[model samples]
Target: MWKLERCPPHTGHQYLYHGSEEEELHVSRQVGAWLRLQGDASISRKHASLKVSHSAQAVKRSICGSIELKELGAKNGTFVKHSNSQNSAESEAREAPVFTEEHRLSSGTEVVLRHGDVVRFGLYDYCYRLVRCELLVATSMLPRSDTVMRDLLLLGGSYSKEWTQNCTLLVMETIKLSAKVACALACGRSVVRPDYLTQLCTAVKQKQQQLPATRDYLPTITEASIQPDPSLFDPNHDRKSVLSGKLFLLSSPKLLKRVQCIVEFAGGKCEVVAARHHSMIEAGDAVILRTPDDANLPSQSPMAAACKVVKRAGLHVVRESDVVLAVLYCSTERFCNPALSQQVLVSTISQSQMQQQNTGIIYAPETQAISNSPASVLSSRSNKTTRTTSAIIPETPGSTGPSSTLIKSPFTPAATATIARA
Candidate 1:
């Protein structure tokens, strides 16, 4: 299994669909995606295709292991974006009077894409990655005659730490800059440089310090949540410490105040009342409290009737154990450390960085996150210019076989270690 992860999920500005097919799976738009690129005026009806096929090997291979992005003949053709390894060549190259002449990607050609192969179009670029490379490659033109393909297909390769760090840093920096640009524009700061992307890479290398390796797993603190300290019942605690997200407690009077204090201590806006304060539950709760078991559902009413009452209210009922999970998922702004989340993201990107690790790839058929598999692929070309670039697989061997590209970190040995540890 291999995947193409969209760093910042929203690829375009607007969205639309006929009312009839709104709920269909793989619902495609008239614009902006593998489903179609109709959002921009510079695009044509059928620019290119993102195809999955059996490797164009001399022999048959069991695993249907190749991806082809073939051009459909149009103005302003496709290009493959290379990393900073060739900055000088890139600057001079794109500035050439014509784009596709030096390296031509003619229509209907198959590019056996590797991980992090950035495919460029008229207005946007997308990165594709091949996972489980050993098996996929074994079946391709790259002869299984060697141990390289044999080991990958049989024994998994130990991911290169240095390569992982560099690629992770590059992806992270892009994600960060994209966010920064968005924030700047939101603050009415119109000026921004796309080149800041590379600078971000440099800065991350400078500021990052080595951290001790640790397990990466979601925390299970919900079940063991601490009761509010007795002193919290103290009338003197600062009210400003209330958390940002709202929490509404709709349960027994005995559990109300203690729960409210606990939630508030974590900075949530808690709403609770004594049992005598209400009859039926209130309507405004974004998240409503429910007991861990049916024992607390009101001894007076039958379980079915109580469930009916809850179902009518449009409330997301969560147990006590879910409190912490909810806060982190919804509003991790105040309580949780931002550093932890960064570490998690960096680690995932590092492990799956296309240039290094190509094993354990899975096709996620989702618009926002990898899910099943994309049921629809959309592409459009420009009607105006005939431009294209040779598909570049960075640092790949000999005569430009598209299956694999192993990239090295640009950081010094000292910085590479620290970045990897971080």
Candidate 2:
């Protein structure tokens, strides 16, 4: 079944349409057995029609197929706002009617409605949100006493009541009920029980506990083990600055201090900005906005405003997990591709260091060999030997000769002369 509830700024009234019973529903101001919006002069006599098409295999009492909305060539026009389950942040940022007078739908143009879609009738403030309800069996047929369904509903109601009374962070909603139904269906059962919810919650908590905390185990960048860009070795430079030159804009107020500490420790700059001041967002700056895990944010809230600004500026919005992984890997590239493992990053750095070492090697100029034996000196000169040396070799503070001298041409005149002079 699908119900259309009036949106905000309007009366909280809903019109229900059962797919099995109603093939079509008419909305108009002048009505007899139709969805009538009284006292609204903007609405046409035959404003729009909702055509319900059910799936061939749809079970009785369950919502299946779709509802097609068609405009009846009204003067004011009809508009729709689609519901985006994915990228809800972006959707919230850019929430607006999909149609206007200039972009009005043609007569008989059909639009398939989905759950959460809002439809505006005419040009007035009158709007209705389409809501879907999944009731697979008849209400009278459902077991009411001493059944798993009854027990689960009772348990959920109790938990909800307790949470409300105690002012706890937990929230119980229809999604939880839907999840229970899904679990029951998966297990070849017709209903959910309280024990199932309890077991699932316990298993979820255990899994959460087993997961590693990214902040605690992030790898620290060390100068000794890895060679960074030579410019980073300036006297004022921070050795631990892996996120140098990057700027982060935090949208969530709660994560300001913790995220600031982490970003600064890694040589990155971060600051929390008000949603109104989103114009300050620069091109290279990344917005760190944590997705709400519990429920959808109110459209008028500051977080939604911030999301709007981010969306308008086309700035990169990353999650806390992405920031953590990027810091752990010591590469801003990891921001977009956080799936990369720590071992892969370590191996990549090692290979980079090896390449730098190989490319930075400075070989000594070929030296002419002077020996007591003319034949030996001639042979050395003809060979034209060169010695490989490090560009920045480490040495003892008080050492006179090279730490480890390379010997070549045993018959050299220098060694022979020293021996004869001794």
Candidate 3:
């Protein structure tokens, strides 16, 4: 299969929506797609009007025996991002942009011909399919089809690693600057360049990074969990006890110490684990939240497909739920989105209550569960913007102590937590 993806150029203080079905809505009403332009096109603000298409009115591009773009060159130039290669012969063919003024393609832009490329346009999302080049070239209209297309084909292609690295740095810097500007405004400083979205391409690139890579799969981890033997729940088994199935946990790393105190007090285990790969959700595992730079893992990390499988299976369709429990490390200071905060609160409560109730003990309301802070009361100021942070507060109280309850880790006691009976 072929793959293709696209990013809209960030041009000044402007807005572009992926699309909308909700009738009449403002530009900001749309979700996901956004860019903030900053500086000039040289140092920063480089805007390129290109939209790579999988299927267009009159074109088809492919690679490795797959059709990458159904229709690449439309209104704006369709640019194909390529990876650099050596060997003049290989370099020449792979590097050239396969476009025509007859088709309106130019340098600094090339419709890549790679298999399994994920192409993202307004609504045309498709994977490359291997098809005959003879079929393609014969069908496409051109004065000198062989000459122009062949020359374009011979163009050397490689990904702009420097472009990516520079864009990444610029994005991080922009985010930092945006945060600073926010802080300054909070402290009553002039918010200059607040609307200058010239720096938005960097943000988009950063967002792309935030998206889970196709190579790896793991739902966001919001709390700590463990995997214990399923036999622990067997009535005939000679297990010590069966703890409550409910547990409440904080998802933020900053509040890990607090979560640890709560878990320990609740007579439960507390340890860090990676966000489970999508493949591992079925073994009854508990997800753990971690920072991205925290690189403490073996090469063959456990892969679980339960979370994704269940999600794709339409668990929400059956349950009608929106709050997905991911293992992410965010803060309370910037945690302003009510919908997100609501889900986080529910997840934490479920973790704590499950641990308390599953430990063979029913927690009574009169019982002094670990003291927890309310999430709703934290961010009452901003009604428009949603910020991400890690300073989550523990607002509610849960059961604690040996008499209180205990549930073993969900997976391997030492490995990632798969769900298990107390």
Candidate with best lDDT: 2
Q: What do the candidate models score in CA lDDT, each in turn?
A: 0.30, 0.41, 0.23
lDDT of 2 by residue, 51-149 (tens): 656542343222254668989887788887776432222233466434223245677788887766778888877788775533232111112223322
Which of candidates 1 and 3 is the stronger one according to TM-score?
A: 1
Q: What is the C-alpha lDDT profile of model 3 across 245-275, one tens digit per residue?
A: 2122223344344333323222233343335
RMSD of 1: 28.3
Model 3 worst lDDT window (10 residues) = 316-325
Q: For candidate 1, lDDT tens digit of each residue in 1-422?
A: 22333324333211111112112112122454334544554454666655443322311232323345566663566655433222222233454322222233576665655433455554444322222222111111112233332222222212121111111111110111111111121222222122222232233223222221111111111111122122211122232233344545545454343244335544564454343222343343334454333344665544334344445553223434233322322333322222224345335334433233222111111211321222121212322222211111222123222112111111112212222332
Ranking by lDDT: 2, 1, 3
Error of 3 at 38 (Å): 89
Q: Which candidate, 1 or 2, would have the higher lDDT against the true structure?
A: 2
